[model samples]
Target chain A: MSRSLEPLLTSRYGIEESWKLANAERAGAYEVARQALTTRKPEELREEVKKANIRGRGGAGFPAGVKWGFLNRQDGEQIYLVINADESEPGTFKDRSIMDLDPHRLVEGAIISCFAIDAHVAYIYVRGELAFSVARLEQAIADARQAGYLGERPFGIDHAIEVYVHSGAGAYICGEETALLNSLEGRRGEPRLKPPFPAVKGAFGMPTIVNNVETIASVPDIVQMGGDAWSALGQLPGDGGVRIYGVSGHVKNPGLFEAPVGITMRELIDDYAGGMLGDRPLKAVIPGGSSTPVLDPRRKVDAPNEDHPLHKWHGQSEIDVPMGVDTYRALGTMLGTCCAIVMDDTVNMVEACRNLMRFYKHESCGQCTPCREGTGWLVDVLDNLCNGRGKPDDVDLLVNISNNMMGNTICAFADGTAMPMLGMVQKFREEFMDAAIHGLPDGVRHDDSVRSMVEGVA
Target chain B: MAFALTPEREQQVDDILTRYPERRAALLPVLWLCQRQNGWISPEVVEYVAERLELSTAIVKGVVTFYTMFFDEPVGENVVWVCRTLSCDLRGGKAIQDHLEKKLGCTAGHTSPDGKFTLLKAECLAACGQAPMVQINDYYYENLNVAQLDRIIDAHAAQGGEDAAAEFSTCATFGAPHGSRGGSVTSAPPPPSREAVRLASQPPPANDEKGEGS
Candidate 1:
């Protein structure tokens, strides 16, 4: 609920028919884009973004301006800009909101991004499940083109641009920049090994800058507000811009919440989402999406549990931190995608971990050995733990498998799965122990004969 | 080959191919068209897509196999994706899946006996706020409980694929909203998006003046 001078992404979220282009323009949608293209040089525009220090909202938190700087301007290749609309991360639905509610914001943002990078064409690889959002975005593109916001020297830019929305066939790995490039090129959605990173070689061997939808969507606002002005909004030096945190799970008013950097996870849940649903005591929260390490803020921030291996590895105690890239990284977790998932008293952490792992196991592109095999192994062990067939060392073994998988894949996918998996096993070892022999912890309602494998049951 | 794009669909495929510099880049869209027309993408459809896109069938097959949404085998008339991710599961996604399984008389990834529905537990449809939702064919039924889902199933179970669409029905609203010039493309380059045709049959509004008398 708390935000800066004005709401950015969610400013027109709830307004009826805000997705329409005319309404969006009436609400000040394309002005910034027009200003950027007409007034500012491409380098100036990029500098404004760079000065803002706005990190990628798509989980990586890589600075957008720096990413644009990677474009090989002198390469003489047709530069490409790909909007990673494949927002397949579990619990992350913020991109879809911008696409469904204020698609012009995204299109304008894409236009500005393309202009900044000097790219002629951009593609939005929409998630297959987001049929409505895609339809809405495609229509937005057509509208923009019809209105001359895109194509053939519109807005007084010398270069014309075309934006297209392509449907992703449904794979979470496709959300990865490299994997997305492969998918975009009509290949299997597997991570292309880096070193020939997308900036150097991407989308049919062209200089490419693939950015998250939210990241690009913020460009228009940054250009209008100026970089220094925008950066000044953040609580920290590098932290600026309003991040649309998609709060899901046990929160009372689960929806997209746009707040500036350094917004504490507590404020996001307690104030914005109206706290835990049904007035239940808080248990834990996935600080940023399901992939980020789950934090147990509900537990008192007591002395370090040295006995816990993760506590020993990270050398951190039971803690409290704000929701930001640096803070999460301090906890050995990433503020991935700004998808905050809340868990309250009634839930079981072991089962929750299993649910998360199920997504990872299913989404692994399978080109990498560690993620393909290790994730399924993690799921099976968690399944055994839930079904009362686990050992005391099973949690430790889970941690071991996670450690082995980290940094050993074509993508950070193994680490994404492993880091969070390690967090669950290390932080909630007791819950796994309880679930192993004694069944689910007290207070959870479940059938005695049911199993906990992600895929076994209907 | 068991199937081929009709001359109209072939033109549509060519239109999609023109969007990309390379023909192969239209792979996914062409496959979507194939799946839409023929309930699932079979080997023949894959080959047909390969021929249209100028890619090898091996490449096409690899792409299809990687994505979970591409059904290689035949599916029922309607496919139900019940989200069983963390948010939805916490907010009764499992119970919704269970309810759907019982109603459809099949487990996840299985087709019903009557060949009308296939219930599958999807990872997340990204409608976490509207937890425990399902996407039947293209229309998303969100904020669902067992009863709400049951009513939807009853309304949709008997309908064929052609009879169902992502019910934007009003041409004016659908086209007017996104600036699509009333849902169909005014440009001669690519054909109207599949959505234009699929959504054209949207039922008239309930309270509209035309619906009352006409």
Candidate 2:
């Protein structure tokens, strides 16, 4: 793997009182935004971002420039830019850190992005649970507006710009772009059917562009350094720039680290996160957020050619696979959010699957039948398997439910839930069979007595 | 009794309304304001919000029920949310939830017998790096073990409402000082006393010409 790059996204993380506009400005916050607004045309800025190859960090990994291209900028139609700051994916916390610590960077990015897309108004839909981040972001917007960087004719440009902070009342599905638009409009936080995608008719029946917090936060840097120069920061050809990889669960120093896109899982766990907690042997890792498929180091590559990026680990463990969008996709998983949750050897695979299933079931928006019902059924079987009540065919039943849920929903939520469900069961089939036939191992059974005390909490 | 916003709060509602293009789009903020003034969203408040936003009661109620943060029923002075997602769970979040239940003498999703706290199991709070954390009111108590949690609950129990809500500090190592002008933290104002809310729910005397206040 290449040497770690200098921090771009996280540069302001450790600065004292970085959330303050003055401190952020002193650290060179809005210089690029000012320059871009004064000197660059909207299309010029958009093309630069396209050349930089910055993907959406919220989870989808879609290129920001491509998403911008889809916008129907009809004359006299109000254009809206919505920032997805909902950061609710189970193991992802990078967006929260950015919003909490260096909110001005996000504000600057939003200012430039809105200008680039010809949007005069932007609403940042933050998860209601993150009260602190919401406050910080709101403050930053107010400060930027006061400093003549956000309101009408900001920075003396002819175009007007406005940014507002809107909070979600704790709905995970709102993280989905369309659902976020609905929630912003004070409607039920349910996913809307797509073809009139947010690009064309969004946010009160106007042209809208929704971009993730991290993706927008990269704009100032891309503008400052020039697109191709910024793109060269990544190890891979297509995947450009650094990612704030967040590591949690059984690591000594579990926190966010800024590294190039193709950094390996071993590098993240060992070099960045200080390795496993107490130096325990690695068991498995959810390479991204909870929705991503779990990767077991013990599993070997099915087929590896010399030309493949993962060829060296063919006979050995696949633990050292590079963490990138294409590489993970090549390995039958995704680099969703790039927030890894590491598991040590002491953890139980069955219980872990149950933990994640319960989350997906609780978060399913109920808009689609397959996701609403399939998630619940998966949880029930996992619960049964964990509590020594599993039927012999429950293993097959779990797989069957997961297979049916995939690609069968209005949104990708059902598919995300099924990815991990199927990943764990297939990777650890024997464990599921063992739990089903003989119940969870000695200390792994569900504590129903305690559970009853907290029932209906969801 | 019919719910009515004070003149000042009505002005605040009007300001929030201007931010959105449509009046009904301000429903969430208006609902939040109602919840802040009262302990929870009573039926009367629902009707008042619907009227204020020019939305139907059914539309307002659907929104309230859909989102998790809005409370339809009265809760204790403090609401404690224990995150039970995978990252925290792997780091002993479940044990902390169990401990809180035992200590508070109530199950999750219910207020304690003393009416001091309402314990709820939260989804991933996006603070996994500091695993095993709980959000008390609007402040987050992170990197918690049983002992740390005990001290926090005890302090809140002793201090009571607003003071206690402001007393606990965040474990965030960087950024502007929380609650500072630059950061400007906005927690749900300390809930009104249960007795006051109950009294407010009752109808006024039949002889009164003007109901409560204009």
Best by lDDT: 2
Model 1 misplaced regions, further than 4 Å: A1-3, A298-320, A442-458, B158-214
Instruction: Tell me how each candidate scores on DockQ against the true complex.
Output: 0.19, 0.18
Models 1 onward score TM values of 0.88, 0.91
CA shift at B159, candidate 1, in angstroms?
4.8
Model 2 over residues B1-214: C-alpha lDDT tens digits? Answer: 9998888899989888878898878988888888878978999999999988889999999999998899999999999999988888777777788899999999999999999899999989888776657888877776665665787799899986456545544524421123433233221111121000000000011211111111
Residue-level lDDT tens digits of model 1 in B136-176? 87766655545545657876765543344433211123222
For model 2, the stretches where C-alpha displacement exceeds 4 angstroms are A1-4, A305-313, A448-458, B165-167, B171-214
lDDT of each: 0.74, 0.80
Would you give the TM-score of chain B in model 2? Answer: 0.78
- Residue A92 of model 2, lDDT score: 89
Candidate 2 positional error at A282, Å: 0.9
